[model samples]
Target chain A: MEHILTAFGDILFHPTVLLFLVFGVVVGLIVGALPGLNDTITLAVLIPITFAMDPKYAFMLLVGVYTSACYGGSIPAILLKIPGTASSVVTTLDGYPMTQRGESGKAIGISTTSSVFGGLSSSLVLMFLAPILASYALKFGPPEYFALAILGLSTVAGMSGDNVLKSLIVCVIGLIISTVGMSPQTGYPRYTFGNDYLLEGLPFVPMLIGLFGVTSVFEVAEGLKSRVKDGTFAKMTVPRIGKVLPDLAMVKRLLPTWITSSAIGNLIGVIPGAGMIMAIYMAYDQAIRANKDKKFGTGVPEGIAAPEAANNAVVASSMVPLMSLGVPGNSTSALFLGALMIQGLRPGPSLFQDAPEVAYIIIVGFFVANLIMGPVGILIAKFLSGIIFRIPRETLTAAIALLCVTGAFAVGNSIFNVWIMLIFGILGYVFNKLKLPHSPLILAVILGSMMERGLYQSMVLSKGSLMIFLTRPISLVMLAASVFFAGAPLFSMARNRLKKRAKRGAIS
Target chain B: MKTWKVDIILAAALIVISVVSFSDSRNYPDIASHFPVRLSIVLGILALVLLVKSLIKRREEAMFTLTGEQFRVIVVVVAAVALYTTLLGHLGYLSSSFLLMIGMMTILGFRKKTVMVVTALCTVAVVYAAFNLILGVPLPQDFFMAK
Candidate 1:
């Protein structure tokens, strides 16, 4: 704790780190305020720019963007009817109705306060929980790690969107791709095909940029053309606010909803693959039920409070699994895992011990970010609410295309990486067309070597006994959880079928 | 049924990849080959299972088909990017990126000549400055250096 505090004190005062944090918050706000672009695009496009920085600053920037984007997204949700990110969709229900009722200023006020409360509460949760989880995980052996990897991989089925089977196939493909470099035990090359670049397996950052950055460019282009055809792309105007800071009485009225939603958000964030959408929806549903007159979806201030707080809370808590277990709970966290990897900072059990400063910065920076986000949001809400129009579509497209290419090329200064990125971009486009979520594949790629290392090591440690996995208690429990979670949807489907049959029989 | 065709083809391709990967792994030392070979087998089985499931359900949706104009734009993007990659060594980062963006913007119908040129050039210059000047990443300088 002393070490954490010392590191926190050091980073808190550093001008450069503070600057990066503020820069990230500003970018996060604008990107999240924009109707279509969000922090995912921001993180993906800006990764190359972060390559030169210290790991701590890189995270301060990315985490700043990650947290503030959730808040910035609500600005548009309240002022415009469009939710900037998918997580903010629920915010639009009450937020736009409030705008309709000429209470945009109050709506923005509740959103900023609720978001800050949720963000800070979850940062506290992250601060205390992630370290404890990492320490306990440090006790795990190779078998336990292997079981944990399987458990993480099992959650990919959930990240698969609606096509679990297709996602599983993509996940397996990533696993196979991870095998391309050298065999860890024997030092023999496996799938290099005589190419020198394949020795390090696939280049991680380029693959990430290709999968994320370029794929978004294609989608943007597609949407742009469609808008041009329909003539429906109207320029939006920025909103004005009188005062956005909520009073003590309003905060008191909102306290219970804020606390409940934050807890729900934190819980969902910890559960791998449950995601922000579920957290926001659950909180929104609970808030509706809590109202005496059920004024939700009809311009209630509490309605904006529930989803806004919950989604912002999710921003920090989702990092809990990623920070401690080295497994991301959702696609957004998966991007952070990519950032961590690209920074050459290995996440998980030893992360806190290996680099106490980095761990402290992530937690402490998150807390500070929530503090800074409140005022920054209030100051910028009126100025930034309808920023979606000011950004030109063509320039954004061309610039992102340039970013994606150069970012891929800058890694190891290889044109082959550019090729790899383009190939992955094409594959990513196809994946999007097929409705396959790329998060599982990205998670699999990141975790593939870890799983393999654990599996092989456990095998060696057990004298070639496959039963080593089942025999150990931690591994056994993890294996059981993997099975239960992975098989959950199928189990529910079967139960639903039986219930439907019973109802049909009763009606007949 | 038409949409299911793509799924079936995808499954078949997975099976093929599994076979190739397994056979290739056989050439590795036994200690290293175990996981890849085993994982390949599991993957192949899953692909087979997916194929069977799709067949049983027999539900079909339309496959994605791009319009001709959209197809042209996509090809132009891929071609421009590929050309940029090809030229990056000799033409240099600034020159090639400028070329690629100009070509793509033109194809995408950015009609104003001066505006497109200025915007494309500024984009490259600012990006080049950030990466090269600030980040200290040395971009390819084939155009400036006398080879």
Candidate 2:
């Protein structure tokens, strides 16, 4: 307790750290409000640059970005029909309608209030939950770790958008890609093909930048022709800005919805691969079920508040698995893991034991970032509305592309990393074309080696007996849960199909 | 091509990749080979399942087909970036990045000559300042700067 309080004090009192945190919030808001940029892409581009700063300051910046970007995504979602981030897709259901009805101010205000409430609520959850999970996870053995890896990999089913088979294939491919470096148990390189660079495995940070940042640039380029055709840049209009805060009565009415949706968001956030999109959708669904009087999709405050709160709630809670189990809950948290690795701070229980200050600072950073995200995000949205839209799309695209290259190169001072970024960028573009989910590939890359190491180590420990995994209680339970999660999507699909067939038969 | 056709091609390609990967992993010791060996089999099986599903279902919707302009833009962007990366070694970070930004702005259809030039230069300068000067990353130097 004393150590945590001291860490918090140090983070809050330190001028430079506080400045970076504020700077990150401001940057996060601006970038998030933009159409193409999101928390993942921005973090991917920023993580390499953070290598120069102290880990504490670096995390302050990143945590600030992570917390605010989710909220910032709601800005464009409310003002324009375009969702700034994928997580804000549901926000557009009601947000844009509010804009058309001249309630844009009220909508933005509700979004801001709900986002702050959600973020702070989940930060508390993350603060309390992560440390306890980490301590409990301290007792995990090789089998348990392998089971945990399985549990992580099982999330591909959830992340798979429409096609479970495609997601599985991508996950397998990612696992195979992860095998490119040396075998952990034996020092023998597996798939290096005599390349020395492959001995260190794939460059993680560059790959992330490629997968997120470069891919986004390619997507932006692809969308340019349509934007031009639709006069997106030619004749953009700025809507009127009015009152920015929700009334006390409105806040009281939204209090239950905020609490319910935030709880849903936190729950989904902690579950690996069930990311912000699911949180928002689930929250929106819950709102629809709860409010029969309110017509959703026609600009209801509950509608905007539900998804806004839920998405922001996801920002902090997603870090729970990363902080506790060293398994990133989603793509954004995976990037955070990459950042931590770059700073030479391995996550999990040992981090708390070895460097409690850094751990606590990160936790406290989330709290502080969330507390300030409300004001900072609102200020940027209120004041910079004109400027945000005025920045030429071409410039943003070029800048992002350049940043991707610079970030990739900066990681190792090698042009080879840049090439890796390009390759993955192209691959990412291809994956998007094929409707394959990037999250499965990312999760696979991060967890693949861990799984292999655990499998082999447990084999050695038990004299090559596979029963070792089944014998351990925690491992057995985890493996069971993994199987259940992995199969759930397929089972649900089959059930839906059967119901459809039955309905057709009855109709006929 | 139809989406099913694309899926079929993708499935076949994946199967081939798994086969090659499996064959490549065959020479490694058991400890080194087990994971990939198993993973390759799983990938092959998954691909085969996809192939079968695509063949059976024959979903006829178009895949994410790109329009000509969009395709042209994407191709130019990729080619330009590839060129930019290649140039980064010889031309240095600042020059290569500046050229890349200009090319990107042009390809993205920014017609304002002055804005494009200024934006490109400013972006490169900011990158160079942040990465090379402030962060001390050893960004590639031009011949003159190197001297």
Candidate 3:
């Protein structure tokens, strides 16, 4: 506790770190406000900037970016009817409607409040819980990591949209792509096609940019051609700060949704590959199911609170695996681990013991970033909200295209990476057009490599015995949870079908 | 062609990739081949299932076909990238990148000649500043470096 407080004091007093945090927040907000630009892209671009800075300052910057980007995404979603990131998709349902009604200000305000609240609540949890969780996570062996990977892959089934089979296929394809490098166990190359670049395997950031950014750009272009010119954008009013805060009744209504969704988010986030998007969607679904009187997708406070709280909560909990076991839960956290590596810090049990101050600083920094996000979000909301809406479609598309191209190229400084990005872009477009979920594909890709590595290591360690996963209590519990979660949709679908048939019989 | 045709084409491509990947796995030892071989097999199975489903269903839906103009734009962009890659070793990063950006902007229908020139120049300058000055990462200088 003393160490944590001292770390906090140091971070507060450090001018350089504070400046980087503010700069990161500003950059993150701008990137997140821009339609088609996401937190991943922002982080990727900022990575170049971080190459020269100290790891502690660099990570502080990234933490700021990560926290604020979530808040920034809601701005465009509220104003432009376009989600800045996949996790913000639910925000658009009510956010856009509010914009159309000329209540853009009110919508932005509520979004800002909820976003800050969600982020702060999660950061607090992270500050208190991460150290304790790290202690437990230190006990995990290869078997536990392998089980966790399987649990991560299981999320693909849950996030497969409507078609579980198609999602599985995409997941399989992703797993294949993940295997396209040198084998960890034997040091033998697999599927490298004699290319030197392939020996290092497919880079994740470039793949993500192609999958999310470039593909979305194509879709945006398509939509631009058909979209009606609604001059309703010009006259949109920004709501005052007072009007945006939820009334007493609204707060009461949203409290359960917020708490429940945050809990769900934290739980799911502890499991690898269950990302913020899934957390947000599941929270939204739960909130809607629970609300009997209020119709969701109608600017209801609970609808906003549920997803916002859930996504943000997942942000902190996603760090549990990364900090404890040196296994990243999601892409952002994976990048965070990479940043730690670049700083010569190996994230494991030893990190807490060796550099308790650094660990505590990062945990406390989350709390500070969250607190800063609220006021920053409100101050910038009115100015940025209007300006972003006014950005010409042509310029927006071109700038994004350029960013995607350069960002993808910069990932590894290889033209082959550029080609890969373009290929994934087309693949992403095809998946989007076909109503196939890309989340499962991405999650599979990320987890697939780790799963293979973990499984092989565990097998070698245990002398080919498959019983290791069952023998480890932590691994066993995670695997059981994965099975239960995977089975949930089937039961729900069955019940829904049965209800529909009964309704039809009653009508007859 | 219908959406199912696209699905069939994708399935066929998957099968080919999987087969090639499986064959390539032969060089690796048992432990090394384990993951890739398993992945290839799973991919093959999935592709086969997709092929069978496509054949059985024969479902037709309006495919989101690209317009000829859109097709032309994409082709030009790809061609520009190819040109950039092919010339990179010989022409160097700065010259090749500038040419690529200009060509892409023109192909994408940015009509103003000045806009194209400005965009190309600014892109190269900014990228150069970022890589060379800021990050201090070396770029391919080709013949100039030897001199």
lDDT of each: 0.76, 0.81, 0.70
Docking class of 2: medium
Count residue pairs with overlapping backbones in model 3: 1
Q: In terms of docking quality, how is candidate 3 classified?
A: acceptable
Cα error, candidate 2, residue A253 (Å): 11
What is the per-residue lDDT of model 3 for residues A361-384, given as tens digits with 9 covering 90 to 100? 777777777777777777788776
Q: How do all the candidates rank in terms of lDDT, highest first? A: 2, 1, 3
lDDT of 2 by residue, A348-399 (tens): 7677887888888988888888878877777777765445445777887788
Considering TM-score, which of the candidate structures 1 and 3 is the better prediction for this target?
3
Give the C-alpha lDDT of model 1.
Answer: 0.76
User: Which DockQ-derived CAPRI band holds candidate 1?
Assistant: acceptable
Per-candidate Cα RMSD to the true structure, in Å, reads 8.6, 7.2, 6.2
Candidate 1: residue B127 Cα off by (Å): 2.0
Candidate No. with top lDDT: 2
Per residue, candidate 3 scores C-alpha lDDT tens digits across B12-92 of 988998898888885689888888788788889988898898889887986566666555555555566667666766887
- Candidate 1 chain A TM-score vs. reference chain A: 0.58
Q: Highest TM-score, which number? A: 3
